[model samples]
Target: MKNDITTRRDIEQLVNTFYDKVQRDAIIGPIFIHVAKVNWDHHLPIMYSFWAGILLEERTYVGNPMMIHEALNKKSPLLQYHFDSWVRLFYETVDELFAGRNAEYAKEQGSQIAQLMHHKMRESEQ
Candidate 1:
């Protein structure tokens, strides 16, 4: 089995690999590319820090996800399928790369984040 996420490099790898799939995914790709217009060059490092902080407790990431996703929801309302696909891709990416506490933590955290985003977005719509 592969090693768990132990360093910033592992986090970067996970984020990069996961987003590569996201950028091409049929269900979610357009939301990210056409709608969000994510600049990978800038987004990737922020994500690295985000995951590194989450998985490694590195305390590196400090951004407002709720604000960002809330804005995205306004632009193109995110439905359940979007969160579902995102979580699916996230778990699949984690499974493909590593197998350990941190890996499981990443999946669990991803689920929680997705759920939170979905709930918050729905609330914003009201």
Candidate 2:
């Protein structure tokens, strides 16, 4: 089915599937397992809101994502790798879950965000 602007459920399912893979992946899995302490049931909805805001411009998510990532950065040296993996998983998840422009839009935004974060992290390391 084609994903519309109001594809929060689709996004949530995609995120959950991505996280399931992330939790099992070799390079990036342990990082999330260690840092994200809460149950997926509790975390998924928050992430759903965050992605919903990003994709649909819904004002549902209020947390500062940069701050959260910054905190996580302090705990890991492979920030770029983690971000890359996240973006890759996100794109794959979207491709698997939905058809049409919404998936493309999600990947475009995700790529931009990942690039920006990678630049910032590299700058901070210098």
Considering every candidate listed, which one attains the maximal lDDT?
1
TM per candidate comes to: 0.96, 0.85
Q: State the weakest 10-residue window (summed lDDT) of model 2.
A: 1-10
Error of 2 at 2 (Å): 5.4
Which residue runs of candidate 2 sit more than 4 Å off their true CA positions?
1-5, 36-38
RMSD, every candidate, angstroms: 0.8, 2.0
Over 35-120, each residue of candidate 1 has an lDDT whose tens digit, in order, gives: 98888899998998888888888887899999998888889889999999999999999999999988998999999989988988
Write the residue-wise lDDT of candidate 2 on 12-46 in tens digits: 77778888988888888887787656477877888
Q: What is candidate 2's CA lDDT for residue 115?
A: 85
- Model 2 gets an lDDT of 0.76
